[model samples]
Target: MRNFNKNALNGKRAIITGGGGLLGPHHAIALVEAGASVTLVDINEKGLKRAKTKILKVNDSAKIATQILDITNLNAVEKFEALQTKHDTNFDILINNAAVNPKMSEIGGQNSGRIEDYNLNQWNNEINVGLTGAFICSRVFGSRMAEKNKGVIINISSDLAVRAPDQRVYSPSESFDDIKSYKPLGYSVVKTALIGMTRYLAEYWGHKNVRVNALLPGGVFNKQPEELVRNVSKRTLLGRWANLNEYEDAIVFLASDSSAYMTGQSLIMDGGRSVV
Candidate 1:
């Protein structure tokens, strides 16, 4: 309870993308508990229902709303602006948590035999969801923040953006390949680019007191079927995948006043996977 008071997010208005995903649901709860009104955005109706239900069970009266729309649709984004105006609440924090991968992993290089099926077309499809979706979210939300010179934009990224990847999933793996790791063409590339965009927006808007940053969360471990999360724990220095709860503190830090003066930096929460 003491921790809650030290850095609470009381009375803030937040918009979260990907709120239906594994990490997004938990993130939404934490924000609401901190006294913020949260708007959960996702394309999955079922996930949205589950997310909203869980939040209400905790508080039974949390000010939470869910918006179902395809982020890829620019028209929908325009409408989002209108909805915000109607509510008379300018977004105080924007979390770009929604993303999609068209065909699993991305494969690159000459020996890209595994992800051959994962071509540029498939790559772009994932990029549109994984990266471009966040791009537009940030574009509209950050633009609003610019008008007031105050807001926080937290972008969720994966460690694969900086670490070596398992190429076997997307492409082929040589028996004796020293590099061992294979990079996906779409997710890794787009996520890496996302960090760049975060930095650019941070620098561009820092003068106005708007903080733009990225949260490169390590692989999220949940009930979802993920071979990477299941099998890769042995490779981690901690020997365990990060629980979904591990992300809450990082969220509070970035969304609360604690991270004031920080911008354009990535708060990576991987459990030593990148270190090794």
Candidate 2:
């Protein structure tokens, strides 16, 4: 339950990709509470249901919608835009938050193995979901926003976008010959490229009043192993990972008029992990 400024986003509409993930619904709730209509899009239908239920508990009357969408597919994205039109919902914000993220302990299983042994299929899947997906959504949805000459696109990146993953944090005493748990190359590369996309789109659409920005958030606390938590805490200047709702206000700022003068920038809320 957050005390949001009721008029902050009055009459606005937002679309959040990866809306079924850990942080997406929180962003949706924050915006909805502030008087925006939000449509949650994700590939996971069950996750979408849970996310919608969670948001409804916060704002029972919130104008909410959901679509089982695969953002990686351009055709699917087009179909979603058509559906929104049928519903008379012309969105003003897009949150690119979908990515292939796995826990440190589960890294090896998620294709975070020694580079030489990394599976190309896994690498392609990561890129398609994290990078290509953003491109497709932006091309289809963002172009519409540009035509309207007023909109905001909030790209959800990560602290790893600005700083390389601390591989040491994923340390496990596995044999050199065995599949090691190194951070996947795709995660950092795709996240970093998102910032690049933000800058380019900001300039490309600035004249049309379409502002583009990115959020480079640190790890969120979600009961990871104690060892991993302690390691991350020691590395962060704030001495802890971010609370799940810590970035809510930041997300709202980026999605609303509060950041009217901001564009082509990234809001780094990483507990100072990149500093020291």
Q: How badly does each model clash, as a count of residue pairs?
A: 7, 0
Residue-pair clash count for candidate 2: 0
For residue 172, model 2's alpha carbon misses the true position, in angstroms, by 5.5
Task: Report the C-alpha lDDT of model 1 over 101-192, residue by residue, as the tens digit.
Answer: 42223323443434645466657777898788888888888888888888999988878777756543322332335432344567777778
TM per candidate: 0.86, 0.94
The residue-by-residue lDDT of candidate 2 on 118-167, one tens digit each, is 78887898889988999898888888899889999998999999898877
Checking candidate 2 for backbone clashes, the offending pairs are none
The residue ranges of model 1 lying beyond 4 angstroms of the native Cα positions read 1-7, 101-113, 168-183, 223-230
Q: Pick the lDDT winner.
A: 2
* Clash pairs detected, candidate 1: 106-184, 106-185, 114-170, 114-171, 114-172, 115-170, 115-171
lDDT of 1 at 228: 43
lDDT, candidates in the order shown: 0.77, 0.87
For candidate 2, the 10 contiguous residues with the lowest summed lDDT are 171-180
